[model samples]
Target: MSAKTNKGGAQAPLLGSKIKLHIEKLAIGGAGVARHEGVVVFVPQAAPNEEVLVEVSLVKKNYMEATLLEVLKPSPARREPPCPVASVCGGCNWQHITEIEQRKQKEQLVLETLKKFNPTLQFEYLPLKESPRSFRYRNRIQPKFKNNHFGFFARNSHDIVEITDCLITEEALTTKFSEVKIWAQGKNSKDLQRLEMYISEEGSVRYGLITDEDDGIGFSQVNRFQNEDLVQTALTWAGEDDYPHVLDLYAGAGNFTFPFAHKFKNAEITGVELNPKLVEKAKSKIKEKRMKYFLSDVESYMRRAVIGPEDLVVLDPPRAGASEYIMRALAAARPKRIIYISCHPVSLARDLNWIFAWSQKLGTPMKLARVQAFEMFPQTDHVETIAELRVDS
Candidate 1:
């Protein structure tokens, strides 16, 4: 355990030092935030408004990380996590906090993050859409197996936490844990094995070890129960206008492309995806000539995209969000309506800032019409948000 002194010659807390603190709130990553002697301390698995004793793990110049030793006073929202390995497994972070509180914190986190990035940003902040089932909603998961230990990795460590069941996962997959373990055992390897398990589109559980040739099922919404609402919300927000052109950026297996196609029968629908597996799957299901799926990176396709003022663009980028070039390109295109779906608040706000800035410089400002957060992955710190943008009148 090493400790360093600040430039002012003040000694910082050494590793393994015990600190009693009152948690004010949860940070973006599900860590309870508290200040000790003017230095911010982050304690994982600690609930907000709770008094807890923590042991310092790492000390930095302005902040410190600690492990929760004991909760002297638990928050009213705190509850026993349903999963047996909740404390050790890194799967669900908010299992200890009440589901209601989890949604509240996520909503607040998104709102605060957006406002923090752009203060003057204003839009209709709708209430957070709650998941129908907080637990048993996940249809896909990646579990690790090694040395007969079959489960997920521990928090911040590669050590596996064996589990007979996962609370947040759908029963369709949980019932096959024993079979998965047996399959993993037959691998006859000593190295840690990475596996992917999910219910296929045909409604059967599929499990296998990941390999270079077999990447398993590509990206898809894990929470199908709530994904319905997410898709519907995106479609409704897109409005009734039959735009001349419709583009679905980062379109994973035509989650939005198919829906948009059905809504706008005459409009030309284009889906740009980089993943060949996902593109192939999306293309296999398309039966209309007006619908096209292109296997190309979104940034590259955007460079050649010919968007019009009557075009509608729906982009659901990965967690890293879209690049500045894509944002600027969309701004310059001046699409009539843009639906930006983001899984991270910080990136969403930052991307929105770029789009609005570029629009202003181009003398075609974009307006954020409305925003809503979705509880797609309940019992986790992750959140999905959808924003409607239109050329400012």
Candidate 2:
């Protein structure tokens, strides 16, 4: 095939164009939404109710992407970022926006995405749950060591932005910065080295290099404080009603499965996971004989297994959301209740649309019961949400 991009790599018609616009609201993927000449524009590092001068960086057919050049009118929710390297670091995108505003943006984005998908759908929209510690809540971080510059990569670039401390990380992990630097220097390798630092289960600081063959531990919730609240919210939304069986899909290390097992002592909990490491960890904590975990992808597991009306389903899918096949299968199974926990609102909304559309086509419709957003990651646009759906009588 021909070269991937144009000669200068302009995706659409309007590259290197500058425009002034009023940001109406925050959109998914951590950007402020604006409209220019009937075309949607997305500006990063911007806040709602703000006027900004932006330069068009990437242009698509329907939407355009812009970089915030100057904030002509700053929003009341804007604040000074605590970290000195916040502007460059790729970790936190909404640090310039206030914590309260960060949550507001997340809630609005989640609601907007869901509404855009299904306008007629109705559900209870609860207030966004805020994290206990906005800063210093992150327990795990991947800091790069290269050419005597040790820190995170800059936004959209491989260049490293050196920093002494990351304010978002926990004190336990930040305190080991000195030791980490020493360990990197002792290696004396010129190439880039990826290192992961986190607080272990026993409350000890641990650091290790990431090799090509051995990637560090699988995906785990970084903010433990907010994670607890998320679990509680999921459990509460699940309600006290008893179901004979609970099926946890995309279960990561039994984060939701364990608590669900405890909450429903009479229910048989079955967790489906693809990662062997996470499956192994989740299996080691098996105290009850009623709980079972399978090492398989959710789509693959749903293919052979059958879900009945007496069972409840709990799904905590990754950012990509559940597959269309799985959603269709769940609709066909017609479970009693489904508690969906999502990290990305766009995918969650799309998945809901698929399930509802399939259920409608199959003549067994599902109704949305409850929904709430969780501000699990502070100083950023990422959000966790729990949605409850039940089969219509």
Off by over 4 Å in 2: 1-14
Error of 1 at 385 (Å): 0.6
lDDT of 2: 0.89
Show the colliding residue pairs in model 2: none
Worst 10 residues of 2 by lDDT: 1-10
| TM-score of each candidate structure, all chains considered together | 0.96, 0.94
Return the lDDT, model 1, position 94.
90
TM-score of 1: 0.96
Pairs of residues clashing in candidate 1: none
lDDT of each: 0.92, 0.89
Per-residue alpha-carbon lDDT of candidate 1 for residues 111-162, written as tens digits (9 for 90 to 100) = 9998999999989999999999999999999999999999999988999999
Task: List the lowest-lDDT window of 10 residues for candidate 1.
Answer: 1-10
